[model samples]
Target chain A: MDVDIDKIPKHLLRFEYPIFEFNKAIIDATHQYVVAYKPNMAFYEANGLKGWKSLEKTIKYLNKNYPEVFTIADAKRGDIGNTSSMYAKAFLKDLDFDSITVAPYMGKDSVEPFLNFEDKFTILLALTSNEGAFDFQTLSTQDSPLYKKVLETSKTWNYAHRLMYVVGATKAEYFKEIRSIVPNNFLLVPGVGAQGGSLQEVCKYGLNKDIGLLINSSRGIIYASSESDFSEKAAVEAKKLQLEMKQILENHF
Target chain B: MDVDIDKIPKHLLRFEYPIFEFNKAIIDATHQYVVAYKPNMAFYEANGLKGWKSLEKTIKYLNKNYPEVFTIADAKRGDIGNTSSMYAKAFLKDLDFDSITVAPYMGKDSVEPFLNFEDKFTILLALTSNEGAFDFQTLSTQDSPLYKKVLETSKTWNYAHRLMYVVGATKAEYFKEIRSIVPNNFLLVPGVGAQGGSLQEVCKYGLNKDIGLLINSSRGIIYASSESDFSEKAAVEAKKLQLEMKQILENHF
Candidate 1:
């Protein structure tokens, strides 16, 4: 779910909503191999009102045409209690997304409102896949690193079962430790391809009996090409990753 | 700059864009007392595309009519490197806001992109005015709390001068400790009116020779009344706060 006016195929410019058209092409081509479509909100938001409309169309298309596929609004949002409720309602109820990414910087009250929605999931940032991730996330608390405390403390909240952690693919070594804290909960792992994180490394320690991992690849798949066959190229990239995951599952199971 | 369809005057609903119309009335009434208008993104986003349009109108109204006043897109947005850059461009460049609030859970790389803008400010969340703030912010690190570390570490980043912090007015006791670390940088202090924080307490320790403190009162002022004269009532609330602040400044000076 990454589209930029400059980066999208020039041919798409003729459409009323090029971003939505590009997304529809990619979704139509790759829906069979993918279980979830995580649209990074920043990309759509950068375009303003048009960007927002494109996002609304993309989500509606998925919900209507491909109900089986999960939808994640990669809008990293969290705030005070009432404010968080508004965000929860916006993303989960209004947008009708299955889940939305959230930052845990504001703590429990900021996050719990999102958990109130029955089937909706809240993906909390634990250990992000970026160089700056080490800044505060990895800071040593009294006994353990801050990320560990986040994983440990969040488990005690209401509707904890609906909580999923965003454990970056870039930090595969931290998977074993993260799994110990959040063994059963699903993990949304980003940074697989473009960020140089090994898919095998993430699967080795990330997989559980439920196959609890939603490995995400943004730039690697969606931006695979910018030509007329952009969606086909995206599908090929998605298929390759899907095949790798299948192989890894066979070896694990 | 908070406007809600349910909370605004019933008569405003007759307008095409009630939220924007309501905001315009409030700004028209209270602009003299205010130096900045901070619109919480959740309210606008909850209404979808129409909500977004209202937000664009509200900001445009402020930029055009009250150019002397600062505009803040209170969108607590932060993501991985490139994604953060997209957000920075959205709020700071595309929306033409003077500043945007950011959550720092992802750390320096997530925040630096927002700071990259020449004159636009980045208000990083440090100690938010909420009960959940205690969850991670107050955690004891090796020597100082996580928030102090946030204040201490963030100062070392590029364009640190462009950085201000969201230090909740709820915990006025922490202001002295916070001032010691970042003495000169302005602190956008929320939780003043509705959340019950003392303007006197915040000004005592949080003030610098530059008088660097932006005290915020949201619900107490904006929702002052839901009747026909809602904006007039809101002006009264805003005036009261301004008077209190004026007295504090007089005594401090």
Candidate 2:
């Protein structure tokens, strides 16, 4: 099992409240524990235009201030070819994140455009945690789960090596089965913390030799405390997770 | 059947584009022939902070200037509950789009979040044109195709009455089958112009009693003329389609 997303980008795009102070406190508190940070696009987007601007500032600040940390645009974007290229230009070129999460529904062409950049990565949706997941991803076709097929077919791509998959942390058990097919690719696991996924279980099945896991706990960490100490609380929560992850990694490696 | 979505906000949440020129040209040219304008979120999003702002401007301009036109934020966004709420707020609340293209792999809670909005609409991915669409969407579950079940189960939601589905124009034959199940609900048809889908055939089986179809031609219209005459050429192309659609509507109605 590998970490979901191996190479994080420079910009951490999300809605960190109280902006500068919030990020500073969080960064100060738990910089050592976290390898990367992801700011969900909707959080900043909900705040309206000014919120979007703040997202930009947040990415720039972290890239300039803390180069050690990897940043991801937690934007699940995918589209047709020419439009996809435009998206590549937008997220990869203009905003300059290390990787962007994408939906794989449009097949390889839609996904490949994003994989063109040498350093950039593409995180494809695999087995998601939500109920609708049962509606399609888990459905069996040709004697295997659809997600298994998604993983298998994705490997056919030359740039599939640059691909990381999004496996909802809540569905950790599937990681063992998912690993049989997609052994080397990174997995970006969310749905931990506030979403109630078991981090221990995820590690049991999802970790690769490379320690390649990016488990995200958004609301649980970011909104840990609404007051001035919010980022500090976020740091505490992150530290706790990281500490546990370190033990898991040590035991396995 | 009905053109959904409310209005775009005044705030600059997305990227800025040459909205007036580009949109006006598309509107003027295709105003009579086309039924909808589907701008994939990635396009606006590619501009980073500026992209979302432009998305807002683009949506607002469409809603205000051309009430007859239908708009879609081809956001292909679907996630767990809390996150889906934020997505709904971002696209439907913050910006006005007639419909949002949602991925149905996540199940009810993920999709229902979008359905809660009145007048606003949700277009679930039933069958897409991509090659890998075969990997999951068409997979046989027991006896039914996954896309078939998606169309069936989505009906369980009361708000689903407001739901439309995405049936790729490329899969035009599926439209005949999809129409049998969802005879009344609208279908948001994409892949017509440049993704190698045909419009005449798509309309043959896809249209319903209300002309329940929103056929989108993005690159075919927007990038019609990359030169200064791009917008003018776009208008000419759009008008050609709209005129054809007008005849279709007249004959069908």
Candidate 3:
């Protein structure tokens, strides 16, 4: 589940309820069905310091209430060595996210720092769902596309076992090529519903023995309805995805 | 001037002074010689909410006192369309930075949102100063290296005029090649002093009609001393770089 704070309904925002309140409502409605709750850091950050405070509150609420539910900070952050170390501390240690989405633009040093934290995952951007994914990610090198090189090179980093890759559901066909590169690593697949990607198509080529795929649908699930019964409407959408996931798991495993 | 807050004197941290105090002293000492002061977001973010508050205070101080100093939030942040828009608002609107660094891996949508803001610059990561830069940035394609493609493709985006590229000082030899691709655009060059990159080499190929380069030296200037007179020591180091920049301008322009 992806929680974009700004996209929450006007009814909630008009009442001046804290952003965390809306998040809490969503968590209450969906935690039982969710394996992880990925919050896009940019959305919280856009609102300034108060938004950050809301994020802190939301994370604390999750830890206290649903400790089993994984939290991914969808912050595509990477920098040089020392700077990357600081970002690792920010998201992993301070905010205590299970993992973070990182851009693989800067190579090993930028990534290795995040991998240093034991048990915390570093979800590197392999092939994103955005139209810009075509810009540089798919550029053909002598050996392979740039995204494949990212996967192959990052596998050599320290704590390579803790690494996962972001492979968009939009490009489900690419999963066959992607899986061939890193067969065992889990794939966080976004763009499933609203982006017009099929869950069945993603599972066909991307699934491994470990059932290594996290299919995400943000707008489709969250904005299913804008009425006062938003949480209940959200629950219906969540249940639908959960059922689809369950069926995929049973058949494949 | 790049302020790595944690690198401030042990006495300051020991006394539990807010990080802004250290930044204020640094700014007071070096603002005259400095064309800009960049605070790496990761450093402030590592300390959590209080750190973000200090970041706000630091930027406010720079804007109010040293209005001439261009402030770059050394935040290499980018995401999808809506998410990228949020990040644009976070740095360009909410925090009100003159510019923020963006990783171009996700392509146009990730970068274009920041460009939408008038008078604000989007410093795209073209070729960074880290060893990991060798991993993908320098990878050759049919036409050119990936970094050159980024420069060429990003030039076609909306508000491309507001864009600046990060061409590392460590690879001063690549400057001539880089300048040929984007002759008019400014390059924000890091890695000059502490990273052993020569300013003269960077200037030899990078200087344009506008003297278009912002060469950065963080550790070399800020960590010149750890004693009570640390800020004074920083001023002397900054003055050396300022003098060097003056000479380069006079000789080249």
**How high is the TM-score of chain A in each model?**
0.99, 0.88, 0.96
Across B1-253, the per-residue lDDT of candidate 1 in tens digits comes to 6676898989999999999999999999999999889999999999999999999999999999999998889999999889999999999998999999999989999999999999989999999999999999999988899999999999999999999999999999999999999998999999998899988999999999999998898889999999999899999999999999999899989
Taking all chains together, each candidate's TM-score versus the true structure is: 0.99, 0.88, 0.97
lDDT of candidate 3 over B148-167, digit per residue (tens): 99999999999999999999
Q: Model 3 — TM-score against the truth?
A: 0.97
Q: Clashing pairs in model 3?
A: none
lDDT of 2: 0.74
Misplaced by over 4 Å in model 2 are A1-17, B1-17, B28-33, B226-232
Q: How many Å off is the CA of A89 in candidate 1? A: 0.8
Candidate 1: lDDT of A163?
98
lDDT of 3 by residue, A1-253 (tens): 3445556776777544357878888889988888899988887777677778888988989989999998899888999998899889889988899999999999999999999999899999999998999999999987788999999999998899999999999998899999998999999999898888889999999999988988887888778876778889989999999999999888988
Q: Residue B122's C-alpha lDDT in candidate 1?
A: 96
Question: Which run of 10 residues does model 1 chain B get worst, by summed lDDT?
Answer: B1-10
Count of backbone clashes, every candidate in sequence: 0, 39, 0
- What DockQ does model 3 achieve? 0.89
DockQ, all candidates in order: 0.92, 0.52, 0.89
Q: How far out, in Å, is residue B3 in model 2?
A: 22
B1-253: candidate 2 lDDT, tens digit per residue: 1111111222212424454335555566566666677777765665566556656777887888787777787878887776688789878877878778888776788888899989989998888876657756787776688889889889888688889998888898788888888999998887787778887788889888788888776666666655657557777777777777788777776
Q: What is the interface RMSD of each candidate, in Å?
A: 0.6, 2.1, 0.7
